[model samples]
Each structure stands twice: as structure tokens, then as C-alpha cells.
Target: MFNHPQAERKLEIQPNCIGDHVRRETVAAIEVSGDHAARSHIPKITALTLQCRGGYTLEAELGISPNGYAEPDYLGWEVKQYGVRDFVNYLAKSPVTLMTPEPTGGLYREQGVEAFLRRYGYPDKSGKPGRINFGGIYANGRDFHADTGLKLVLEGFDADKGKITNVDGQIALIDRDDVVAASWGFRGVIGHWNRKHAKAVYVPSLMRAPPPEYAYGARVELCEGTDVLLLLGALASGAIYYDPGMKMERADTPAPVTKRRSQFRVRHNDLTTLYQASVHENIDP
Candidate 1:
């Protein structure tokens, strides 16, 4: 729980225990809001609406602004909001996206995104014209996907040791001939994970829309003391999976549009496995 002193020390914040202060402030923000619905915080663009406003709304409550920094959100704590049907239930609506780092090596990096898509991608499932997508669930230890013909592989990670044996090693996708299709290096993946997820707070919320709004729940989860080794262990065991939504629009055109979405995800139940300690606190008054 947030008030537990042991939980605060789990982050190993020395001297003043800044993690404790952050936890207190987060709880205060939720408690102060009471039972009111938080309005969307998205900057208004005429006739534009974001379906995923729960996280944005909660960020607004905590006075967090959207940015591209690869670091914690508030006071060195990454604030993440997950949707739940009921606050009491706290059932996860979907898998949590851990990170979205593009392939730092392989054909995707050598030949560029368009070439990679043309070689390994398929026609858009939605039948969108001039669109090709490289999308699938590529889990560690799983065989090559029937559609993509790429198998997910972890290099230089020792399952027995549960550690990253090589910093240059990568989480990669390989074809039948062992051609590296796409890969995320150990440094890039671990750096991004450590910077933001070393200490994090996961908030569950209920969202509804007539005018578009969200209601954050009283139950909040705080996790701390995560390292690259633990993340690699999860990846090796297939607990975390590569689920990309990369696509190229206007494929036939000389200047086509490309969207690179390389995401690593894990089920909510598996989130605690990556952390040294996790506490679920009731932030209600």
C-alpha cells in the first residue's frame, strides 16, 4: 500500500525517500478528485476526438503534459492508466504496452521501413487501398507466424542465468533463411525500459463518453526496482511479446506514408513479474 514504509524503500531512493513523496502526492491527487468524472485533457482540434482519453485525463489530474521524453512522467515515477470496467473489479481491458522502440538493426534498418514492409508485409486486412501492414503476435519460443513468416528470437539471453549475456544482443525477427528482418538491441530496449519503468504507478480507471470523460479508480498499483535482467527473463519465457502495428499507406506511390509501431506488451497479471516489489493501495479517503 502507498502508506507502507517498506514499499517506499523498495525503490532504494536514499536520504529523503523521494518515492514516498511521489506516492503521497499521487494518492492526494486521486483523493482530492473525489468521485467526479474528469473531462478530456486533449488539446481541442476542431471535430477531433481521441477514443483513448483515460490516460490523458488522469495525466491532466496529476498536472502531467504529454511529451516524447523517455523518462518517468511525474517526479521520477511513470504514471500509467489502465481501463477497467469497474474500479472495484479492476479488470484489465487490454494488455499493457511496455515500450515502442523501432528496430535499431536488421533489414528494417538497412533497407528502410518501406522495403521491409514490401518484403514481409501483407495486404491490409481491412481492404484499405494502397496499404500494406506488418502486423502479428510474435512471441518468444513460438514458431514462425503463418502470415509473416518470421519467428521471434532472443539473442544473447541465458534462460538459465536469467540475465542478458550480451549488451549488443537483440530481440529479433528472423525468416526461414535466418535473415534478420527486424530487431531491437539490448541497450535500446533496456535503456528505454529502465528510464521510464524503473519506478512506475499504474492507475485503473473507468471511462465513458457522451461528451467524453474518465473516472480514475481508488485502487492504484505502485511498482519499483525493475532491471534489464528481469525484462530479458520475461522476454525469453514468452511472457512479453512483440505486437507491432506497422503499416505503409499509399504503397504504390513514390513517396508513400509509413507508420512504425514496434511494441512490446504483457498481460496485466504478468506486470508484477518484472518488478522487485508491487503494492496495490486504496487511495480513497
Candidate 2:
């Protein structure tokens, strides 16, 4: 629980304005010296995956509830967590999974995810029988992925202007036969980013589990001034890349199980490049 009276005072004094309630709550959470249970209301965890529990646990501590919208997580701020070994030298060099937007156009959408997977996917590298997968790190100027035989392409954004030339522009995956394997449109992608991440915070955590638990670090990174144009420019320059993990299980069966995860990612060090300003502050202080 947080210091509610102080929060109430802040809210009363600054009605309709952004306040330090989130920061104060975050600091209060940091002061709770122990591991927390894996939890989140936004993405209610039916099964706790290794990569997901850290953020969920932190969200639980922050008292955030599920509100289904492409908007901020906390009082006007998107809260995200990244795992680290320790709080010391807390700037972990991990790739941040920015967003997982499904393809809006191309065979993936028009023909369906399963069809597109069978057409462009490779046999599961792990030798999981009757499984096929479509995944690779693809960026501008990169050649076709050897296994998947697909290359990434950006459609109508002019790199010189650092602005989208067409709202219909896309980040597309093209096959050898010139078929668009999958594509994400500019409008949806841009809207998702600008709305959810206009003001955002990244918290680092140390995690352990069988029953998952997490310990959040005091230091947090806050970023602001997000624009779709900055994201487009990063895609154009290869600083941000498309990395998908779409797969079909029991491919031989008529009703194959499918998992879809189309993601855009940037290095932790490169996070500031996507926003106008970014700063690190110790919540505990």
C-alpha cells in the first residue's frame, strides 16, 4: 500500500494536472525490501511465462488495474519493467520489447496467420516434430533471412524528411516471390506508440521463481515526447528492427495451434533516441 494521504493532498492541489503520485508510490514499493508475487491486471496471467512475470509483479506492487486501452499504465505514464542481475550498475544492456503489433496487411492478414506460416515459415529449429516457425531479426538493408527467405522493407516513409509520407505506409516482410508475407501499417503502429508511450517509465528488476517473484530496483528511467516520426526514422535507419516469433504446432493436423508475436525492439542504450528527453532518477531517494 502507498501513502494515500499525501497522494490525496497532491491530487487535491493539482486537479487535472500530472502529479508525483506515481513516483511516490514507486518509491514506496521500492522500500518494501522483498520479492513480490507475479501479478498484473492488464495481462492477467493464466500461465506465468519466464519473460513476463517481472513486469506483472511490478505492476501488482504499483496498484495498477486492467484498463483495456492503448493508453498509459499509471497516472498518465506507461510503466514497464526489465530484468537485471542487480540494482548496482542498473543500466542493463538488454533489448527492450517495445510493442507487439500484429500485421495489418499482407498474406499474414489476408490469407490468415496459419497459411502465411506454412508458406513462409521454416521447420522448428529445435526439431520439434510437426512444428513450423517464422522468426528472425530483420532490418533495413539486411538480406533475406537464410532460413525464412524473407526480407524486411519499409513502404512510404521518407528517411530524409524523418516523417511518414503516407499514412498507408507499412513495415513489410517480402518473400522471394514478391509476396508480402506480413505487414504492419503506419497508422496503427504509430497510434499505438504515441498513445501508450507518450510518457513512459522503465523499471529494472531482479527475478526468481518456481512460483515467480520479483524485486524492483530503485532507479528508474523516465522518457517523454514520443512521436511516430521518431519511431519511423529508427525503423528506416535499422536502429529498431522487426523480430517476430510466430509458429504453428501440430502442423500435420487440420487444426494446428498457432502463436503470434510480432515485435519491434530497440536496445536499452538506444531508448533515448526514440524520445525527445530521457532521464534516470532514483525513486528511493
Highest lDDT, which number? 1
TM-scores across all candidates?
A: 0.83, 0.83
Pairs in clash, predicted candidate 1: none
Q: Report the C-alpha lDDT of model 1 over 1-285, residue by residue, as the tens digit.
A: 112211111122122234543333333332224233232564432111355656665565565676667888877788888877675578999988887787999999999999999999999988999999988899899999988899999999999988667879999999999999989888888789889998888877665555555555656778887888899999999999999999999998888999988889999999999988777775423
**In candidate 2, what are the lDDT values of residues 1-285, reduced to their tens digit?**
122211111111111212333223222222231333323333444323454656665565566764447778777778888867666877674688888777889998998998898888999988999999988899987999998899999999999988777889999999888899888888888789888988778877665566555555656787777788888888899999988888999999887999988888888888888987766765523
RMSD of each candidate?
A: 6.5, 6.0
Candidate 1 least-lDDT 10 residues: 1-10
TM-score of 1: 0.83
lDDT of 2: 0.73
Give the Å shift of residue 77 in candidate 2.
0.7
lDDT to native, each model:
0.76, 0.73
- Per-residue lDDT, model 1, residue 103, is 90
Question: Which candidate leads in TM-score?
Answer: 1
lDDT of 1 at 238: 93
Deviation from native of the Cα of residue 147 in model 2, angstroms: 1.2
